[model samples]
Target: MNDTPGWASPGSAPSDGPDGKGQDSTGQNGDAQGAAPQDAVGQGPQWSKEQPPPAQWSAPSGSPGSSGSSGPGQTPPPPPPAPGQGWGGQAPGQGGWGQGPGGPGYGGWGAPPQGGGWGQGGWGGPPAAAKPGVIPLRPLGVGEILDGAVSTMRTYWRTVLGISLTVAVVTELLVVLLQGFFLNDSATTAALDDPDATPREVLNALGGLFIGTGVVLVVTLLGTIIATALLTTVTSRAVLGTSVTTGEAWRDARPQVLRLLGLTLLLPLIVAAVVFVGTVPGILVAVLGSSDGGIALAIIGGIAGFVVAIWLMIRFSLASPALMLEKQTIRKAMGRSSKLVRGSWWRVFGIQILATIITNIVSSIILIPFTFIAAAISGDGVGLLDSTGDSGWAFLIISGLGSVIGSTLTFPITAGVTVLLYIDQRIRREALDLELARAAGLQGYGTAPGATPGG
Candidate 1:
């Protein structure tokens, strides 16, 4: 049989009984060997010389079989069962669940098949797949992937949460400090709030805001890259039911961190370039004199570019885990991701978007209360929408605390989902479950003793 379950060789499968020719051969063989009278004569006196009365050999007169014609002293076969009735003797429609018309009813298992079926283990179904850790070693469904991620977090809270917390605290601390030092200026906040402010004032205020944002973005990006790298190791180990320490995860992930970072940075740049290329032509046309045409063309091009970018983004989403787990180069990792995601683009995209939406909603649920509390504590009274208001040190710290908490909780989820998705894709396309089973030291898996799993 193949490595996959549920497929069996024809000779190994269950059969109804001996074929018609085999039955004929058996009957002929028995006739040629002579009936009981010949054996009785040869055995002398051990067997009865005279047969019983003919009436005793025939079926009972009132029985269903008695009506059928048969030779003297030969029993007639019983009549066929009524419609809907099967081997279980229950009427066809009277059977409970799983009772097909003119077939066995629910829980009405008949005699075992000729080869071997009903008497074997597990109701004659295929063996259950092995489960080494948070997930079963087989192709996963969407719900199973999500549950595996959550299960990993729950099962290995120490490693997963430790990594997420450290990253979140450091990232949020930097954001708070940067904002306090650079973006808390009363002048900029006042100018931004003023409706009568000139374009120059607004631009200057916006410039400060953008700079602060850029710094935070860089810091956050670094934190995310680090967190994703470490968590990839943790999740992979979890798949094999192996526990890893934060230090061990770090060691495992450290070698490929640079490659992961490059991948993380490269994807966005690629997407941005696609978008930029699309809009540039329109911008040029607009500047060249045909403003309306240029605007229309640019919009169309931008839309098309955005669609392509999204496709590429989903296509390469699994690259990070591939790079981390497989120690693949950036280009090869991207290629691996593309190959795994081929023929499953929509499924991958849907899963990714669902995870993102869930994490974002959870983060928002956690962060919103902190935002209000920060506003209230800082004497701002819920000016969350009014970005012009300069947030005090108190507000920044409180909000940063919220950000830290939110990130700490959400980081594991996002990272786990991505890693699990990568594993799921590989299992579906490349039979990765076999390798995972072998790595997990499971018995009775793979092709043979010490045999390596195939792709």
Candidate 2:
């Protein structure tokens, strides 16, 4: 036997058992070879005798095993390692011999090998960026808002009805009592026309009428402010699904009364001032002009007045709600409301204008017939046909009754739209829907108050 390992001969068989290192003439290992050879230095048919064939290793063609005698278990020996390289450095899925980070060796196959950090094909990629101006409106419809108002009234009908009726009745009663005892219009014009009337006498009578009317107006103004503030408070609480007693609503709104009154007074005064200011130049131009110039000046004044009116209306539209709900000072509340409506001026204007028209039409339809009946029953309807007209009491009674009826019928729609508009703007600008949802007892999906969404 050759002193060299039995692997020297290309035709030598591998071992099958413990210590026998050589192949027999038939190219088969003796039963004494331990196991199949695995390491490259142990190659040869005798090496094979020490080790069973690799389970699935296949030999390349044109190698030493090209002979037909090689069994399927036999495979060609792997190529030698490269210089300065180790067994583990080979790239995956290449042949059994190549250079790699670890050194020359068989490499695994699949995805590229990753470094240890997150970005190196790992699980911690950068988060997605948020898109802008993509916030969605809550699922609210006009009918739903209207229904909420009706529901609120149903829930607190006593307070709303009582306050509203009290205002209407008191307003009408005072108007009647004033017209009856104080400024009788028919007698005033007769007194004004009297030839014997002195200037001082005339001035005294005029002052009395002015003071009486002013007192009535102040009473009406107070009633309006109190009623509106309370109504707004209840409406806001109701829409938010929160409970509000009449007393609580009234109490909460008490501190805001002066602010709201100032707002109410200031808004109209500002509008009137604008109209007065804008019309001054136009009126002067008209007074000093020919027909064409006068027409032009009048047209200019009208346009300016219209624009200022719309601006004032939009500016103060949310002021009352701001006062009642936010308890903001008059100037600050107006500023805040103006800020809230900055980008949505047109929408707010349109909704308010539409609501106003609808409320007016509905109120008119309900009250007009009553007004005619009151007029006819009080003789103003017949006095229009009679030349000796004494319809002062008749006119007062009819107008007072009409106003009371009209205000009662229109109160809910007006108050509802105002509160809804305030809430809508907050929803749009502040993401108030989530807060509302949470307030309504919804969970898992609703937003918390003052918590920024998707931050």
Candidate 3:
């Protein structure tokens, strides 16, 4: 062997006896070769330095000691990743992106989200049909109603506040004028205020009071009818995520104003009729035949009438919106409102009551301070309700300013809540969310030109 291999160095030999020197033409470790003698059953090299070491952070997978190998010298393929985790083979404590923290089985550290994407489920889906206008195109919660209403006012402050301020100023001005002219400080009025006044004097004073009251009622009613009709148009458009000018609102609402006025007048008349019908018998009994039975009947009838009137009001709460939005006639609007409110009486009632309370509470909070301020500014010489209250210009201006501010704030809140409630009821019962969403330009809401209001 030494004679035949004289041309080559021993270091480059393919096979060699254990040389103390670590030299090799083929890639094989000197330690591994020296430690074990190989038979002719295998290839030259079993392990290579070029191959990577097994990933430690990646948990090992195999039989007890087999390591998924066929024999003692064989290496196995890696196991598949566990479910609900990333496929990255990164080791633990590595904060690199695209890899699960703590290994392939955990989802921490911005691993690819495992949940299904948008439109797969109802929650956390795409905002295709979410709120796009003053309200969302779905069933609403109490907070959403309040929020939506406020949103409408904020969105269309120019139109909404303008309408409110105009109406309120006109109203307050009319009241002051009526008081100054028709309700002048008459000495005879003092006699009527006396408890022991004569019948004739009392009747005269009562007649004058009734006339002034009628004038005030008429002015307030006319103003409300106009304001509500115009505002309803604006609210309807607002729900569809559309803006409208006062002129446009008026143009759209002009046709409905008379009808709305009729409806408003009719409702109060109906309530009056109901109260009259319920209490007339009791009144007659008390007047014609004074008895405990008569008193009880009057009390019972009054309570029952009050309850019925409230029910009617709640039942018809949606009529104004229906009429303005749907262009429905008075009777149809009433029918539509009744239909919408059929199964949701208490909900509508509670929401209406709450909105009214919130509106009034906020208004009172604003107006009360102004009232006290006005009285103080007037040097305590004028009470707000006192007929002989001096024309302290500063006091009048401050009080009117307060009224304006309160009206401006309250008007939008009440109007928005009422409109949103109508929309909500329709969404619950008639799939109106789809219509609203489409109108608001949502993509998947069918024939979508737009989407519902959120602002």
* Clash totals for all candidate models: 1, 19, 13
Q: Give the backbone clash total of model 3.
A: 13
**TM-score of each model, in listed order:** 0.74, 0.60, 0.70
CA lDDT, every prediction?
0.75, 0.60, 0.67
What are the RMSDs of all candidates, in order? 10.2, 18.9, 15.9
Instruction: Give the TM-score ranking, best first.
Output: 1, 3, 2
Worst 10 residues of 3 by lDDT: 5-14
lDDT of 3 by residue, 196-277 (tens): 8899888888887788778888887787677777787788788888999999998998988888887878778878777777
Clash count, predicted structure 2 = 19
Clash pairs detected, candidate 1: 84-92
| Best first by lDDT, ranked | 1, 3, 2
Model 2, span 372-416: residue lDDT tens:
776666663454432133445665666677888777756766887
Runs with alpha carbons beyond 4 Å of true place in candidate 3:
1-128, 377-398, 446-455
Report the lDDT of model 2 for residue 335: 87
Best by TM-score: 1
* Candidate 2 Cα deviation (angstroms), residue 23: 50
Q: Which stretches of candidate 2 lie over 4 Å from their true place?
A: 1-139, 190-218, 286-295, 380-395, 447-455
